[model samples]
Target: MHTPDPHRHTPVPPVRPTRRAAALALAAATAAVGLVVAAQGGAGAAVQGSLAADTQFYKDPTSQVVKWVAANPGDSRTQVISKRIASQPQGIWFSNYRPDSVTSDVRAVTSAAAQAGQVPVLVAYAIPNRDCGGASAGGAPDLPSYDAWVGKFAAGLGSSRTVVVLEPDSIALTTCLSAQQQNDRFASLARAVTTIHAANPNAKVYLDGGHSTWNSAAEQANRLRGAGVLNADGFFTNVSNFNTTANESSFARNVLNALGNPGNLHAVIDTSRNGNGPAGSAWCDPSGRRIGNYPTAATNDSAVDAFLWIKPPGEADGCAAAAGTFVPDIAYQLAQNAPDPSTPSQPPSSQPPTSQPPTSQPPTSQPPAGNAACSIAYRANSWAGGFTADVTVKNTGSAAISGWTLGWTFPGDQKVTSAWNARVTQSGAAVTATDLGYNGTLAAGASTAFGLQATYGSNNTTPTAFTLNGTACTTS
Candidate 1:
């Protein structure tokens, strides 16, 4: 997730944390002009190598995945991003940021990502009055023209790889605009989603959800509803910003709960650079933030949809370089040496870090004795192109898990290339598993994790079901 420091610019006071108005205008223009807009949708090459490497580890065929891989090579965390994208069958992204005069060329970009076996991560920001000249600046001029531009923008979608992140900061940062302006922005966004879906139904669209520190669940839900969250596939949170996965997940769940209809809504998180979490709510180019859990598809709760890299990390947010400019040197340094927040500290903690989402809170009233029920969520942290699985297991159950086992079946006939964090051995149709030094002897209502690094020939399937001590988890 990417955001500029509000305090840095005096003109743009940090008023209630709002969306970049330019995104709204961009949607309007795209609607009118059609997707033949311009070529301003792609990212600069600041952190292209690492970002690309992260996406290629899974050996996905998505154009964006391939773009990232083709851009970067010989790095260590390459496999991590690759595995994350490969875990899921599909995803949606925005196009690179280009001007409105040239062709939208959505098909060309989508084809590239599709060929890579992944989806393009598109960012729709060519709106008017974008960013209000704040941290995330630059956008189309006004609403009337924006509508025309969006029309061109929509026309660019190809049949292959594509996942559209429609106008990030468009909703969460609406506080800067008046009610009429807000309404206009929502109407424009609704139009963008409609146009894109109409252009290509396969193209998944996710609206931006403000970071964890920004909005309360109810506030964001109302904002989302006003912005037509129901009309879109799902909403996105933590784009080009900083927040831990655990914190973002919990926050998203809370927002979904406020919405009251999990069936109609899904949420995605930007896990690009949140490994070490945020630094005291600062949004500027702050030091010490490491990459968070790479983008993955493991769903701890049923409501949240997928984790994505909407905000390509290392792409300077105007501070490091031009906003949205992808600087490879800065990106490489970030990937290679981001600050680790979890490391044993020699000083006091600045921000309050929450433990993994509470596994299982004791029931106010116990269920029937024979039906003592508890749920556990498993997050597969490591999985890359070749083959590997290093999963962290959280025993969100009530009873102490004396002995535990985690297992999954691949999509094709893929086999584990290697194993780590736990003991893993494959049988005929099943793979037996055990905890590792890092994840074992999970106390009642505690959490632990383990994984295996494996290699795949040409046929490796995503694990269908995972069992903890023979108990199958609810994976939808």
Candidate 2:
């Protein structure tokens, strides 16, 4: 958990109207303008309504971006920041170690969310030795104090539907502790999970399972079991990291399978800033990263509960600024880099729009080849002799793909070492990847990504050609 910087806190003006209130007011105003004007604005209104309707998570109006936007209304980037970052639902972190006021502080957010019939995502981040003396270091002075603090934190839930991401990097980053210290920490976390459930049975507490690239699935599952995850709701992966959602989802399921699929456990992934995936293993604020899938619980995968904005988009990861400090420039960059929601799913081509329809209308005598129905976008971060690549496969055809096998040939002498989300095999320079059951189906216009870790001798040239199920695919 990244501690909030007190010195960087911006004074929030008065608390403005809540999002639900403002949306209601806008609907009333739009109705007063009559049918023609309402018709013109229908698409935008529907988009907003659909977003609200899809998620049960609460959007806190007093979030960092909200306060920043309110304080700097005249700023040039305010409009985009307000609409893209401030308006989204994100976790409200309780990182400060204030036992006395912690209950009230947590109650305020939970109570407000309950009143609006929405679930609040809360991060319980006061575990002892947090961040292991890294940039986000400093938690409770000892484990005993942390247990008491977590009890107070749980008291604030007050029977509301809530999600508590318990101590990110707590179980995953334990190399700094000795063997006994690690055992003590695990017992402390187990007790804390019990305390939370005892206080609020309705609350869903998740242990941290780390990110995909951090540890192997079997290793993470063993750590999770030691932390009493079987008694909790499940585990969360990539809390504040930038791993892609598809990789995280596959890793999470593998972890669950290793755990013997205990109870009704499910995982939630932090997709707040992973739209462009990771920049190798860089955990700090990286450039060119974009806001990922918007906060939602309607994930198609049963093993995954939700895709959350656990790490708010604008906050720095200690490198760009003090950890957890909101930076408007980073917020603008992330929002601006995200894909335009209204744009067509197909990637832009050199041909003009007017001529596209004529070319798309193929003769009925022969249907479009399977090779022309798919596209792939590959991105890699390389250093020295090794690199990690994320490949996104989009099915642009009219029908769904039930199962898929992707093939590519490396231009350089690259050998696949390990992969996630798909089973990969390499023969000389040729690489073939097949789905791992859970991610096989791709509906029309839908996309799924898989990643691999590989080694190259000197040159790390990316593969230019790709094929899906023996059919050629367009590459970007």
Candidate 3:
């Protein structure tokens, strides 16, 4: 028997940063964002609930909360949230570029998951101009550099089946870029899919589709298609936001339908920090949002692959704390306040509506447009990501117009995808939905109706102003 080395048995001093030893532990864990691969939610003292035999995953002990709970018993938040949310499956954000360790980390996580009969979920968010130079900026300097980084990132997946949530906001948030920049970004994303698949055939890659409250289904579908959805597994929604599962599921289905992918591409929704919905418009670590459903691949929906905790509940979303930093109290609140999925909600869309009448200084209600005075109404059945609208035009004037045309601009990149009951055409956000054969003419004091579908990027506000044949219509 060999004697112990002088350094092998050295005593280490503990660093107690206030009552929350969990905070200290959270500060030191690897894998950014919510790294996936595991059991239901957080596990307490003895790790309750039985594994789903062949349905569930995420057993490798790699969570920050796991370490915090084990290291800090005094911190009750560690046991509270960690038992249910943190100890479960989550996604890993390979945000930093440590090429040397990237391979090992990927192999370690995937290999462990595979050994335990689980599939690991990973996030590759190192695209150039990531987050549009916002709080989480500084991705690869350019496309070539990003490609090289993708190579290293994909190199980590070692044959075992893995689910990869690729590039959050890369597609849904492309309004920041110009036409040429968009082409380049899409090319880079396409390159990422090819690269990941070439490296690991077992890897299922998915591009990001903002959220239900953000992009419209059709617009997001086109964006997803442009970014090469065919090459990858599918697209994901609500990566780090608080949109509800019902809204996300409906929005994602609409997206997949619009894309018309032959292979019925699937989708995944992040059920993290969406319990109590958003606290105001506070997306960055809002106060009251609670943890959502536990991670599960057995999502009954045919189009949905899994309901995952993509963004770990406790981690701050670049606002409340230091961006990705974790706060124990926040974690505890999320866990404690998590809404019971078993309990049916009063309303399906639990989150507060973010849409408002977003328009330019147009005519108010019942404003006069031309000699044929007109009043237009803009109403869209909107969810987080997309919406369909019905516009009713009434000729307040006594003249009966032979034909009519309506024009409007979306507050954001809200583009019309399809139109019916009118001849609709959209260039950028400017829409021109001219009347069809029967509804073209408006008799004196007569009103006609036309409906259209459009998709938006972020803000799904109802168009504030409406123009009838070039004159602004009044809201009143």
Candidate 4:
């Protein structure tokens, strides 16, 4: 008789982390709005309020952001970053082809989630020619090695529910491969899916279906079919891409329809950084983007399986830093720029408001006596004709500032289109940003942040001069 696996039957203790009660309330409030999902195992519902406090998806304690937070306790951005970006559940990427360690590595994460009675999102990215020789390259040397590696990967599921995002860009970006090579790749993907399902029937494996803006739905469906999508649970879209959730949802539904809407097939979308939508077709670390909806299985759409953060926010897309490396500044910017969760719901606007110069002038407050009153830190990410900037206003004075207005003049022809955390208005190259009541007060040595999205014609230079309440401020 075969001995049963020892790791399979570990008893899961009751999960009652302190944040669970509060998360339940937030989840209930947003359930009607399609922001929260029911918890796995039917124990209770979960929301994305605190670090996997109430979500079915497990929050990996060893995630890059978590390590960053622990390493930099005194960083000014730590509090917000900890509460927002670091607290969320993100995909744990298994990108290497280390067959010897792959099973144990996978088991560690899955077993942790199992003990917590939560599901884990895992990305299988070790396919040959990964990323089409782009920034994220390297994988198993050949198809046979990859096939064996995938079998070991599947063996680590350990009798619990899990979500696996298999080989992003595999089906969608196979243009460079020859006819026979493409056929071989598809065969490998199909075999991997079979192995995963056979290993753990509780595992839901999703194949790659590129974003809405990439291939047409019919074309993607055909490719997914060729890669054995019918045998898989469904396909996933927008992995690591910045496409809006609404657009992705529609695109996924269209793809399902094209795939004959098999009852067993569905779609999951990567809503990691599509809150502000795409910056045209520019995919590599574009600016002005925000974190989208928190990961949830209750998308309220029958055709869609779940909305996932397949790409962890703040990890560079090979531009800002090496690909997959987490940058703290980007993480802070994304969390700070996210929409206010407590704001009342409003009708979705189809178009951005027309850009026009400010009609009213900034408040005329007398200048403070010295340059020590305030200082500013400005950082920006630019691509082609557009960019986004994050500005931090530090109170370098001894007294509290009850209200504040920040003014600056662009050295170039940059035009502000929209803003967040403050009210921004532009006239010619001059811009004024006033506190929006909530963030006006800054105690001695305290700081606050705001951001803006803008466009430029030929140049995009940082503004050197700034003023807070009409007092000149130093720049960094």
TM-score of 3: 0.63
lDDT of 1 by residue, 1-476 (tens): 23421111011111111112111110110000000011111223211211222232112233233345456666565544333322222222222234343133444445555555654555566555555556555556677666766777677666643556777777888657888988998888878788888878776677767766566667788888887778887787887665655556667777878788657567766655555454433455555454444443333334554455545444456666555444454444445543222221121122222212122431222112221122444333222324333355666667665555666665555555333334567765467766432234566667654444444556555665776665666543
Evaluated at residue 352, the lDDT of candidate 2 is 11
| Ten contiguous residues with the weakest lDDT in model 3 | 1-10
- TM-score for each predicted model, relative to the true structure: 0.54, 0.67, 0.63, 0.64
Q: Evaluate model 3: give its lDDT.
A: 0.61
Give the CA lDDT, 0 to 100, for residue 143 in model 2: 90
Output the lDDT of residue 273, model 4: 65
The residue-level lDDT of candidate 1 at 103 comes to: 34
Candidate 2 lDDT over residue span 1-476, tens digit each: 32222112111222112211000000110110000011111223232211222446777777767789999999999887776667666676666677887787778777887888878777777777777877666678899899889888888788967788788888988978999999999999999899999999888888989876666678889999999999988998877776666667777888999999875698877767666555434457767666665565545456766667777777777678877667899889877745432221221111111100222332222222363379999998775666778889899888888778889999999998766556689999999987655466788999877778777898789999998887888887
Give Cα-based local distance difference scores for all models. 0.49, 0.67, 0.61, 0.68
User: In model 2, how large is the Cα lDDT of residue 71?
Assistant: 100
Instruction: Estimate the lDDT of model 4.
Output: 0.68
Candidate 4, residue 77: Cα displacement in angstroms equals 1.0
Please give the lDDT score for candidate 1: 0.49
**Candidate 2 residue spans exceeding 4 A from truth:** 1-55, 339-425, 428-451, 454-476
Most accurate candidate by TM-score: 2
Q: CA lDDT of 151 in candidate 1?
A: 74
List candidate 3 segments past 4 Å from native. Answer: 1-54, 339-476
User: Between the candidate structures 3 and 4, which one is better when assessed by TM-score?
Assistant: 4
Give stretches of model 1 more than 4 Å off: 1-104, 327-329, 337-476
